[model samples]
Target: MPDWKTTYAHFLDTAKTAYTANEQRGDLLVQGELALAKVTVDVASNDITNIEREEELTLYFQMKQLLNILRAIYNDQFDMQPEKEDALVAAVLYFVSPFDAIPDDAPLGLFDDAQVIDFVHEQLASDIDRFHHEM
Candidate 1:
């Protein structure tokens, strides 16, 4: 298998491009909702322990924040532009996706998900802060 770092970099680049290009698509909200649902299920199913075992408490908190951001967006509480919405949705999709830089079943598989969540949080920092403040 390829080095995880390299694979993760590639996934990030590809995801950014795809999400940015499709930012104006009509079905972006639907896609985001579906991805959020999957992530929520995973969260409810004790998947969070993976991160806890990995000792990435910061990432664990970021994941919860990311989920809240998505939930706000889905609930129409956040008035984001189409492009921003698309980017946010793409990030969620990346986190929920099983076939990522490292397969989710692999050892420490959630490391990639945590990385994605961290990246997304950084990218959407202002929006996240605003959402939290407004809530």
Candidate 2:
């Protein structure tokens, strides 16, 4: 697997490229990136020694929420459209790998949700048709 920095850079670059051609396509990519970032921070920041079992459950729940949001963002692009299953699965994995960017146990885990969100918004600033494309 590629390093986190490389993976995130690729994601941002790909998202920008996609957005330039299709706003909706780009927005979906950005949403996925942001969602991954959110989960990464939530998981990486917890004090494992102090982490409660319930917190683990909550983390899983939050992760699922983020995934659902991503699915919803791409539902239109996916719905009723025939596409390569491998490509679709690969895309999802690409967006998600950022969560595991740094070793979870590393002290001062890398990446932050705020930074990721800012990156997504900045990268997609000029084009927001994707946001409007949804009903």
Candidate 1, 1-135: lDDT as tens digits: 655455556655654566544333224445544654644565557656765544455655676676666666656676776656655665566655677777777777666767767766787889888988999
TM-score of each candidate?
0.60, 0.33
Residue ranges of candidate 2 with Cα displaced over 4 Å: 1-5, 10-69, 77-95, 98-101, 110-114, 125-134
| Model 1 spans with C-alpha error above 4 angstroms | 1-54
| Cα shift from native, residue 63, model 1 (Å) | 1.7
Write the residue-wise lDDT of candidate 2 on 43-82 in tens digits. Answer: 6665444454344435444334334434544554323212
Tell me which residue pairs clash in candidate 1: none
The global C-alpha lDDT for each of the candidates, from Candidate 1 onward, is 0.62, 0.43
Q: Give the top-scoring candidate (TM-score).
A: 1
Alpha-carbon shift of residue 78 in model 1 (angstroms): 0.9
